[model samples]
Target: MSSFEIYGGKKLKGELTVQGAKNEALQVLCAPLLTAEKVTISNIPDIVDVNKLIDLLQTMGVKIEKVERGTYVFQAKEIDLSYLETEDFKKRAGSLRGSIMIVGPLLARFGKGFIPKPGGDKIGRRRLDTHFDGFALLGAKFNYDAGEHFYSIEAKKLKGTYIHLDEASVTGTANIIMAAVLAEGTTTFYNAACEPYIQQLCKMLNSMGAKISGISSNLLTIEGVKELGGCYHRILPDMIEIGSFIGLAAMTQSEITIKDVSWENLGVIPNTFKRLGIKLERRGDDIFVPAQDSYEIDTFIDGSILTIYDAPWPGFTPDLLSIILVVATQAKGSVLIHQKMFESRLFFTDKLIDMGAQIILCDPHRATVIGLGRQHKLRGIQMTSPDIRAGVSLLIAALSAEGKSVIHNIEQIDRGYQDIDIRLRNIGADIRRIN
Candidate 1:
């Protein structure tokens, strides 16, 4: 476990480049495993989640060569199927949630995929029913060895069919698409997740010769091809990180410019921040957020208090609700932060409430923040990070607080953010990583 020590009340300045999308990178990294040819990927974020996926691939005998800091070439020339049953493989596979994605590619190319129950941040019940259901819909036999506690799917040959997902699962759709692209005939996915990350995965697969249609929509059609060839793919900018930065600038009253933000892809994220009354300027490809002393929340059409909630793609991402809740802490008005996707995500509001912010944790799913109007600065205190998004939210709070703050178990933060402390320091953030 690691910790972050921060001396509070520093208004940061200068610029920070948003890292490549961690979510998209995780999906695209698994695409190459569907082919034996070499695949080149650029703009790869060096985060724990992505690196852990890369390591999983390496353990399965995928050849990966680094082209540069954010570039790599991967070739799945050979894979050890038997290695998947090893204790070493099961232990490592269970460590990362993204490792579940390997199931689709392996089942597509080798007719079988195996994994121990996957692990990730214990935010809520992230069900794999959508994943296995999609695979079963694609003509794969789903099986679980209760004695070994292993889940697997196998098929003599995958044939495409119509699948209406129980939920619009992002990773589940990606896994199904990966499997479908190599199956016979066409596959239709209704109620599909249309997030930018999923769209990027579709495009990367198309470049690799997978025929996918209805991108950026809830309904998708995939024309299965005999095989997919390797191609170069670059990931999109991380929207979660950009949202965190927006909250950072507003919370710390800092003038900061976010570089190479991929403005076209951010959907409703920028506008969501504007609803918090933060001043944001779109400078070409970058977003310049000016320092703010006080900002007020906007009400709904019926004069109700502002409510921020999450939905499927092309909507507000649930990942940023933590940041939004933190930023609203110092705003001039009240707003209800609704995290409908995950049950335990909003539980960390207790820590924010402990730090002198007026917050009411209505339940495991919602919190209402009564803004302090910047009349009083928060006095920092020691706290442990409950999860990745909450960790960054606490960091933002600590940065704007009046005293020192200590955050333990920051490895949760490291899993998604790439060199976050270093990047923040480049823009005048007073934070340090310590053992």
Candidate 2:
């Protein structure tokens, strides 16, 4: 087991470059299965999830080579689809939510796909029903056995049709889009997810000869093509990492600049940070956060105590709520945090509560935070990371606290953020990784 020991109350002041989008990179790397040519992806984060996916792809007979540290050349010219049924594949596939994404490409290329139950953060019950529903709309039949926990889908030829998703689930939308790209006819998806990650995936697919329109709207129209060609795609900068950096800067009273933020693609992120009374200056494509004496929570228009809620695209993301909640502890005033998407995501606030913050747990999905507003500092303590975002949130809290703090289960953080300790340390954060 590894842990991070942080001597707190040091402001983070330096310029840091953000990594590529983990979510988008995962889909792009897997999208190569749609073609039998060489596909290259750049700006891929060197994180656990990406490494695991690379391992899974290599095991499936796809030729993968690291052209550079963050660049990969994938040649699926000789992919063996039969490996999809192997126990080895199933074991690795079951460890990631992104693994289920390959089902679409595999079904498109081989007319069949088998995937085990996918795993990710155990925040709530994530169902594959929406994914299968998309495939079903594309003329795929799904069979699952309770004991097996595996899904076998078969369709001789996918024929695209109009699909209105029951909900705007990101992965669900991506899965359907992947399946529909090679279908026999036109496919129109309404109420689709239009997050930047989704848009990037669509753009990459389109670059490979797939036709997709309405990139920034909840409605998508795709004209199915018989075959897709291999293409090179660069993953977008990680917005979640940018948001985390903003939160870290605010909490630590740090004056830091985030390089290569892709400011235009960060829809609603700047405004969302503004809601916390955190100010950011734009320097070209970079975000500069000034040293703050204190951060204040903004109230609603009616002058009532406010609440930051998570929703689908065009709304705040649930993943960043953990960082927002931690930053709120040092901000002035009170705010309610409603995590509607994931039930267990906000439960990690118990650790913050133990650190002398004023928080009321409404239930599994809601919490009310009354900030101390820099009048007090959180005392150092030991903690165990429960999940990915929460682990980073704790790290930020520890960085701003008094004395020393120790955090365990850093592997969860490593699964998403690449060299988090080294990067933060470079930015003057007094954190050390102990293995």
User: Which pairs of residues clash in candidate 1, taking residues 3 or more apart in a chain or in different chains?
Assistant: none
Tens-digit lDDT track for model 1 on 198-278?
Answer: 998999999999999999999999999999898998889999999999999999999999999999999999999999999
- Regions of model 2 farther than 4 Å from truth: none
Which ten contiguous residues of candidate 1 have the minimum total lDDT?
372-381
**Candidate 2 residues 1-435, lDDT tens each?**
999999999877898899999888778888998998889999999999889999888988899989999999898787777788889888999998789888889898889988999887778878888889999989999999789799999999999899999999998888889999999989999999999999999999999999999998999999999999988899999999999999999999989999999999998888888889998999999999999898678888899998888999988888899998999999999989999998899888999988878889999998998889888889889999988999999999999999999999998899899999999999898889897
- Per-residue lDDT of 401 in model 1: 95
Measured against the true structure, the TM-scores of the candidates, in listed sequence, are 0.99, 0.99
302 in model 2: Cα distance from truth in Å? 1.5
